[model samples]
Target: MLDNKLTYVVGANIKDEKLRDYLKYTENLSGRFIKSSGLTGKIRVNNNVAKLNHRISSDDVIDIDMKTDEHQNIEPEKMEIDVAYEDIDLIIINKRPGIVVHPTHGYPSGTLANGVLYYFKEKNEKCIVRLVSRLDMDTSGLIIIAKNQYSHMALARDMQSKDVSSKESNDKDLNNKIFEKSYIAVAHGNMENKSGTIDLPIGNPNQDSARREVCDEGQRSITHYEVIKSFKNADLLKVTLETGRTHQIRVHLSHIGHPLYGDSLYGTVESEYIDRQALHAYKLIIPHPRTGEQLTVESNLPEDINNLISKLKSEA
Candidate 1:
């Protein structure tokens, strides 16, 4: 367990501003975050709970409790993790397959969160774990974790903007954009189209086999794909997401009759080469929350996928 309270100092410029405005200006907290925290009684002033409309003054101490979910209190475990990048604000990790991103049913520990917590403990930094995005347990790739609430807020807002048309729209402001994620995958079939876009609506399907499908009532999802290399019976694709949804790449590719290799849930064929879906988050471009500078990080293909590709080439 970790302490969640965050304290802020009122500067000279915003001396008499309302608590809400002060938070927005100094901490980059959003109105939605403020309201959500208010509902949970997470915001306080000088140890007393405060409202969004409460006026703030110079030298007045503001205490805020970071919001957390039910599983945040999980004990840390000393598991090995491949760290790609780390700064005061966030950490980028090259997650391996078979490791769950967070704790869930049948898996209460040995998660990425637990490993990250232990890593932080070793460094003597007591901070709550905050994941910016998640990859499926069987999918290996680059994922980010924020060190504090401020960075989390910025990244979360950027991700949300892709779904809704807000003031933080990418067209309106490029610097405030969240992240652009790129992936590489080995699909089951030889795709006819070398490059194309999948503009389809995805929603819950009636079938028990799949949680989502392309339907009329589904949300609009878009995936851009380009074939990188053609193998004997498969194609390696460089896939990008215009709109991120649950299993967007898997669902979209599967809908096109070319599912990911070894993806039992979506692919028609069972691959003997790999145990899980051959999808890897290869690259990510994120703007720094504080500096607004674009930061690009890349993750290499894991050994399993590399070996599979080598086998395909040798047989070709």
Candidate 2:
């Protein structure tokens, strides 16, 4: 029931500051948003229209309406979607393997985005599907979608500001981050170490190839992993990403000789154990786009992965 509106009460510390300064610095709104809202007459103070230069005092109420008329060209397909979390500002979906997240060149319909659009239509909600993150077609896990432009902007800003490469940080520092993503993966071999970090660079050799590799000229990538359980042939790992390079987990694991089971692109080919890559986005922690409150969402392993683990257990 929450609308596309933002409200703030001026505090003593920010009193007497220009509205533009408060919004740009304290509220973290982008310059584009400020200009657009100002032109659209969506900025108000104390029930009166206000400009970006308006001066405010303590106890002043500022409101910004953030509604949009933008529409997506994607066709809405009626399909079942696993919604893990939803609010007026955003939604988190538990994506299944073998389904693309959005429309692409080769995939135009029957995607998660199409299904989400249909879901919104059914609920009579006027919202666009703005994906904040994506999972590969074979990777099953949580995907975030912002319901409005303002929420998308806020989340995107926070994601860009996150320092995912902080290896020596304490628990408090970790808790202060705006977003955290975790995964569960089954690798081909039993790892020698119980826990470890892989700090490397990943890049594609050419633009025509879909493969990613660790190379000297690549961008910095970091992955931290811990052994959750060991089988005779493979090991279960809880992996946390510091940098979200394309195929970072697969490339880094393969570089360290622990490629994920069934990962044909960067590791071994599909086997009887699993038909797709044995990777799942299991958990996510993010701050509410509007309220700045912490939110954590999780998804259990899919049936194929659970069966794979069972098969591995039997062999042990």
Candidate 3:
């Protein structure tokens, strides 16, 4: 079970409301979380054990446990994982390309989540592993794993605050942003300028649709890129995403005539420098969930990308 607890103050408008109604409507608690806490007898009202149907007053204090009930079927597997940082609240790991983050179709084992689960089990920690951000299977880089619900909610809210496409809240409150993620990539052609921003819109299509596209009806997507090193045939770039959308970097780069090297899904021609896409999430900056201090985590380029860079430099 996680150490973090969900607490809320009952408002006057929700006076005399049932405990379940207060949790569901007033505090916006998840049904799954409530159910799990109910089974474990962790739900409380005014520091007294209360049932879901208990009536709460206007000034009542509700405290709910944040433990999660997940991965009922998935078992932990011990695999080598590159840990970048670890604390009581969260962990940052360098994920390799070609391996999915979590268990998905055709890959139920050997995933990063499975490895993390084993790590937690070895440490004798009883908490659910929560991924704050996701990277594509072919995209390698630093990723965050929250140890509790509070940290997960903080990091997830930070990501959503930076997202210009989120209609849930106003984007003017930039001070609330607590995380910054950057990437390093090798694209097909030499960039036109040293740095520029791509402010396009991304559209999510139906489930049967193959891919997202730049369209008028799409949400606002922004990506800023700077040419780091120019090679004979390719350019190494440092890309900072102002808004995270699915395939934003790849799509924006491809739209500007510089598809990522070895990106078969979005590139015009095949690449010999690398087999998988040359995109790496090199840097991740986030505030500590408990302390509110800035934490910067980074990872070096993998062997294949490093060797490709060396080959390009030698040729240059």
Candidate 4:
């Protein structure tokens, strides 16, 4: 097993006994000559420090080196990106389907992050490409990027759940300050109403597939969807998100029996164009962190989806 050594004193609130607890919590860091030095600048920590409440003061130095089993951390390749709008605050890209947002387990490189990094490097802009939110690899749509850490943190704080107006009363400033996210989804079947809201809770399906499902005990999720186009076997939809969750739209719709056409995990695939799920992040409304202005952005349907719709229409 590889080893990484690290050192750090407990934060101010932590008690003396909790210092060991903090060390044990952090992964990686193992050494033989581990000495617990009194409050010093940038003390080193070892692997076996997992405790809480270790009394540490401000400006305490922390150093840790932990073992990381060699996972594929490869260089990212370049690709084309649909630049919708860009400014110092953020950037919006017309994200496409079948592309992972960031490098992860299965995909270590050639992700959207790689492409965005390349874009910034080409322009010689020394800015960090941070994602405020992410869309799944298979789901295509707009993704918001923050140019710096301040914008990222501010937008993230505003994205937290806030009290929404029930009467549509005044409070316009507060309304615009909070992030309002929206999307468009096409379900496999028609619904009872042309437009309706689903107030359901979402939870991880208690199964081995690692998929999400709708459960009463899960976090509260709300999806507002409207029927866009009706087909013989399927219907195009415009789904707006009142609350964001992992697989929120897909799980909620599948629970109501209107699973998406190309979704294999939640719903069974039943058509020739069924390769990936038919979901897209069509619209996004966010509050400007610096200016506090409202910004709405959207992405059009990709060509493959547009052609699939045309073919489905022709077959019918």
Best by TM-score: 2
Q: Candidate 1, residues 235-256: lDDT per residue as tens digits? A: 9999988777888899999999
Each prediction's RMSD to truth: 4.9, 2.9, 4.1, 11.0
Where in model 2 is the C-alpha error above 4 Å? 1-3, 164-175
lDDT of 4 by residue, 209-269 (tens): 6698778778878888888788876778888776678888889899999998678878876
**In candidate 3, what are the lDDT values of residues 1-316, reduced to their tens digit?**
3346767778777667788877765554456656767777888988988888899888898887765554535578888889999877899989999888889888888888888999888987776669998898889999999987667766776677677766523644434646788999999879879899999998866556746777888888999999999998799999999888888899889888999988987887676778888999999988776556789999999998998899889998
Of candidate 2, the 10-residue stretch with the lowest lDDT total is 165-174
lDDT of each: 0.83, 0.87, 0.82, 0.67
Candidate 3 residue spans exceeding 4 A from truth: 1-71, 168-174, 204-210
Report the lDDT tens digits of candidate 2 across residue range 39-102. 8899999989999899988889999987777689999899989999998899999999999999
Runs in model 1 with CA error above 4 Å?
1-19, 22-28, 32-71, 164-171, 174-178, 207-210
What ranking of all candidate models by lDDT puts the best one first? 2, 1, 3, 4
As a whole number from 0 to 100, the lDDT of residue 60 in candidate 1 is 84
TM-score per candidate, chains pooled:
0.80, 0.92, 0.80, 0.70
lDDT of 2 at 234: 90
Query: Could you tally the backbone clashes for each prediction?
Result: 0, 0, 0, 28
Candidate closest to the true structure, highest lDDT: 2
